[model samples]
Target chain A: MSVNISKPSFQPYTGEKARISRAFDYLILVLALFLFIGSFHLHFALTVGDWDFWVDWKDRQWWPLVTPLMGITFPAAVQAVLWEKFRLPFGATLCVTALLIGTWVARIFAYHLWNYFPINMVLPATMLPGALVLDVILMLSNSLTVTAIFGGAAFALLFYPSNWPIFGMFHVPVEYGNGQLTVADLFGFEYIRTGMPEYLRIIERGTLRTYGQYATPLSAFCSALLCSLMYTLWWYIGKWFATVRYLNKI
Target chain B: MATTSEQLPVSLESDSKIPWYLQDLPLYLKGFGILTVIYIGLRLYQGAFAVASGLDSSEPAFEQYWMQLFYVELAVIAVFVTSVWGYLWFSRDRNLDQLSPKDEIRRYFTLTMWISIYTFAVYWAGSYFAEQDNSWHQVAIRDTPFTANHIIEFYFNFPLYIILGGSAWLYARTRLPLYAKGISLPLTLAVVGPFMILVSVGFNEWGHTFWFREEFFAAPIHWGFVIGVWFALGVGGILLQAVSRLIELLDMLEEAP
Candidate 1:
């Protein structure tokens, strides 16, 4: 159903109008940078907290599954507004990059400097490659369906490999005290945390570990299936929040 | 009858060098500078004292270093909220109906600055300090609710950001014509939703009482904050509302040279 408006079409502004608009854009740029860093990081920290924070918690099962699942949420919601309204496809990259900056700073100052934990123990994982791909798919396809299915899968699938380089050395096996533990597990033993309780560590449980070699891919695929659904759900959620409705009262 | 020069809109006759759209830029920058110092100062205080006297709550030094700061934070929050909100409310424009398009446009710019500053406060409270809470908890045992980080984070930082967010909402409601006439849903959702994060502190602290320490960061007990921060996405709608109104206002003005 096509609809036509009698009002004159809006045209590109020049001179003072352009300057005012550009200035507003800068203000928005600054606002959005902080907004995503603060809000998305909060959400990521609380939901994907242990997995992203500790190297030992970055296991074959939960870390691969939970990280991408939580990571895609803000990017999808942001893409809904930014891509749908302004035609800006950088929403995923913007959110991911902001999250990285927030995580890195916290890891250095909060974890390493203040608490004196080693940097490697608290290093944050990167989702940049996946975020880049998500933005690209949405920009090229311009279909929420295609983006959700393809972009969402790519986001989950690329998370592990992208982060592997930063975390791989920690996964190297070492023999100590009649038990073999990865270097990451050694960090957990060396550092005493309130979260160091045996029951609290929810990593690599169930029969999935028996599949040792195939476990990560299996988790990633499970996350891929979940993320596609999450991306679509959040897209609508983003649209709903972006509503321009005015209420007469509370 | 001919129109007199005195009858022209004040915006049209302004001789001031500052652009009408950016008149609030100095105040905005000042607000940012002040907040940065406060956050950094708090961080420094934690560095110096958190490990020394903050480890034990029963000691007199804990009362001095930590509890005193908590009490002061509560006082500052009370005074700051009352003064800022009261000033915004009492000094509200009573003649919004008579607001010129140019003046209305300028108010929108100011409103954006208020929101920008609010988000800046959120960056400190939500990203930097919020994660630091985990770092602090991981190392330091939870003896009291008013631990060093909690004193700075829960008491000071969270409330400071809430005040700024509320101020942004109040500023828009009192000064802008559309906001004064009808409450903007997006604006309300964006402001009120994050405000709930402050409310969820009760739940969070209560849960911590059971364990006396953080067991897992992603546990169900901490989900309250995650849910609350999602409402920040309402900013998308606020943008749409502002842009649509700005377009109409800008169209009413003559093209600049």
Candidate 2:
């Protein structure tokens, strides 16, 4: 909270020129704001872009585990900085919004214009309750440790269930070439991936073979435990970032 | 009103002790220029490599191109890392306890510039090219260690971050006394975390080989990378340490009470 890092206090403008200058500054500020947030969006999408890209990868076992594991990092970092530095609690919202914008940009430029992939296939799943829960927990507790433990669990556990509504359509069973196929599996067959053959996919292989419907929940639970750990470690990261010092050497 | 470089809105003066270039030349511009060259070069390299490798969608034609590029990038990265790191260690300040506050402030500017470049580099690596993987991988088959996506994203973009992050961390350790206090934890994490993504590349290569050469962005192997870049969060602490001191120094230049 040094003077420069904190917002500079400005007095009311008395002159018309000063007023015009301030207006221009606001306009420029708006532009920079979009660009900065746009970067956040791009960065956020990198975490889950692959999961959303292919139909074959959206199986019960790996998809749930992989998505939440990488997805939560952005929120954890953003929450750490915004809450600790500015006492603001909009990290969750910012994360989700940034991600939406990033994926929208991706689908628009990459899928829509370049390849003309279907929007339904390219659209990323919304975080839904998970993001909101993190913000609420942080707002209530006001302690990074508490937020990490409870908030992180909520983020992970909810990720699979929250996204189920979106991916459920693809999972619905439909008749195909030799036997029954889920819409997801059929999409994989229909789309011609010259580089990605059917043999390359590793879906529903391990616990999925043994546990059927119960596999995703197990993944979700494991995700919560790891998410809690990542959040706790990253919280210290936030506190460490707040350190402002000039040392005299080791 | 200050206008000239000599009268710049900075309180500290080196008294010709610090080099003229550090004092006169703008730090941000130096960083900006170098990063621009690297970025444009990378784009050119990727474009050319894609064509050369058959990443232009002709799956069968490009089989050998990616594997060869991967090995070459790996070798180049090894040399690049060693040379830059050796330069930093060899050129470190012999006596940190004797440096002036002015020098410290000047060094901080350089460090900030390094980070500014590092931030964008991370964006290009972790997000832009990383996301670009979806477009390319979904469109092609990934049979080798170097897929079209991996050639640009992992080999080119990821290595750029290592260079930028390593340089920034080295600059701080060699010049700043603050880092002498057992290596600033945030700074270490800032450097080490992204550096871990390099470790993750091992996981990525192994996973691709042992398992199918599939492209799933959120696979267990890939988590290390995305999380590694998330360590860029540590830049927060580095900023706090710099921005406050910078403001105080600027106030001094203004002769404010």
Fnat scores for every prediction: 0.85, 0.25
Q: Docking quality tier of candidate 2?
A: incorrect
Model 2, chain B only, scores a TM-score of 0.75
lDDT of 2 by residue, B1-257 (tens): 64687665354553445442245235555655776686566555555666455454345556456556667778877887899789988999989898765566567656765666676676566555666666766665555656666776778777878797888888887887767655676666677887788788888778767654466554566666656665666666775665555545434332211
Q: Candidate 2, which segments miss by more than 4 Å at Cα?
A: A1-50, A55-66, A95-119, A144-175, A178-183, A194-250, B1-110, B134-147, B173-182, B199-203, B221-227, B243-257
DockQ for each numbered candidate: 0.78, 0.21
Candidate 1 lDDT over A1-250, as tens digits, reads 8797688676789988888889889989999999999999999999999899999999999999999999999999999999999999899999999999999999999999999999999999999999999999999999999999999999999999998989999999999899999999999988999745868999899999999699999999999999999999989988899999999989
| Tens-digit lDDT track of model 1 for B1-257 | 77677766664547667788888999999999999999999999999998998888899999998888898889999999999999999999999999998898889999999999999999998999999999998877887888889898888888898999999999999999899889999999989998899999999889989988655788899999888999999999999999999988888888986
For model 1 chain B, the run of ten residues with the poorest summed lDDT: B7-16
Whole-model Cα lDDT of every candidate shown, in order = 0.92, 0.65
The numbered model that scores best in DockQ is: 1
> What TM-score would every model get versus the actual structure?
0.95, 0.64
